[model samples]
Target: MGMITWNCTEVEEFILLGLTRRPGMQIVLFVIFLISYVISLKGNVLIIFISRISPRLHTPMYFFLSNLSFLDIWYTSSIVPKMLINLLSFKKSISFHGCFTQLFIHLCLGGSECYLLLAMAYDRYVAICSPLHYTTIMHSSLCIKMASGCWIGGLINSLIHTLFALRLSFCGPNVINHFFCEVPSVLELSCTDASLNKTIIFFCAMLVVMGPFFLIIITYGYIINSILKINTSVGRKKAFSTCASHITVVTLFYGTIIFMYMRPGDIHVANQDKMATLFYSVVTPMLNPLIYTLRNKEVKGVLLEITRKRHVP
Candidate 1:
């Protein structure tokens, strides 16, 4: 009992055993992640800016896209800067409070994103399935409510898990074998029996991640059926094109998350987990804005107009 108690001294900080130990690799990774982070911030901010100024993009789709941009900005910012710093610095330590804060914010943004994707899917469904009732159903008030619900649900879900995690006794061996603080990564260091913590993670994930994912699948199922019903081949192609960007983004985001979190902690191969975390946290945010804006004619047209206006001077 004495030895056990001695081993269970409350941890003050944690060392993040980041992606690589090789000095050369660290430098290369730092440069790559830095560029990716800058591009992600710039791209998402531009999306928000264009969404605000462009009257043509004042519809529900762009509105949700703007929310997604805002979320991606906040989400990536929560994880990447710290990761970049850790990659360059010799001391890869984060304080206890900082870890919790990161965990809370990361979960909040991720959970909200899941629901936001569902909302976007529903918007697509309305646009395609019941075109006549689209405006009536997705009015300003309802859109605001749906967006608010996504954020609020995410916050509530994060708060629940964070509060419970705080109750556990984190004893010794405080090196986290991942880039940033995540639920499963942190739980690995707990001196207490972390079965409960793992259970909460699984349950919350099912609700926050899997639940929205299944909804998106169902919504898209309806959407694809509707697209199939279109008589003209051109009409069907156009409809599929409208959805292609979104489908790509969804697949990218959900695929990484499900692969990372849905499995048991024991099976999470260390290097693989680190790379997967990088993909979702760093890579996905950068890709999202590029995917949406590059594929979207309305966004391109607005950007071109902005460029033209600047050149006019």
Candidate 2:
């Protein structure tokens, strides 16, 4: 066991061995990451614009969609900008507090995203399965409440876990394997008995991560069942189409997540960890607006009409 010490004077910053050390790959990584950042920003902002323009889309569903887009924008923006700079620059060090702040906000947004996905699934299920009460159950105030819950719950959860992680002592091996400061990566640096940290983190995960995931699955299960029961072919198609985009986004986000951090870090390939982290953190957030907003007819219609009207006068 690495000897534990709490000498704040001992450490000021930590080195991060990012995605790759190969200087040859720097330019290639910069180009690809730059494109991703651009697309992500455009896609999410477009969603927000469309949601605001379309009167017909001012319902609970679109309200949540708008929030989701906002979250995606900030979520990716939190990591990708700094990471892109690190990829191009020789300096790849992060201040100890900055690292903790990044981890805190990252986990908070990630947790909220998980719940937002589930909330969306629930919205779909109610619209399809219990159409009569859809309005009552998903009222404007209720929608706001649910969205608030996602953000507030995520903030509290992030605070709890990050506090525990922060208390642990870091020793000699100050370099993190991944690009950013994740819970597990930071815990690995601790020079103390990490079992307590691990246990607390595990509990936090059950409540914050795994719990929402299971709820999403249950909601989708009902959604699928309700779709299958529709009598006419067109009815089923309509029901499925309403959800296809959200479902696709959910699968992409959650699939990568479960595959990445659900299991113990030991069995997985160490080098691939950064790649998996990239998928959920960068790739998924960038693609979310595309999957949920761009292909959505209402969103697209609103966007087109807004742009045309702006030039009309």
Q: Pick the candidate with the highest lDDT.
A: 1
Over the stretch 154-248, how does candidate 2's per-residue lDDT look in tens digits? 89888877877766777557888888887777777777767776676667777777888899888889989999999999999988988999889
Residue 84 in candidate 2, Cα distance off native in Å: 1.3
lDDT string, candidate 1, 194-226, tens digits = 787788888888998899999999999999999
Candidate 1 accuracy as lDDT:
0.91
> Candidate 2: misplaced stretches above 4 Å?
1-9, 310-313
List all candidate RMSDs to the true structure: 3.2, 2.8
Residue clash pairs of candidate 2: none
lDDT, each prediction? 0.91, 0.83
TM-scores for all predictions: 0.96, 0.93
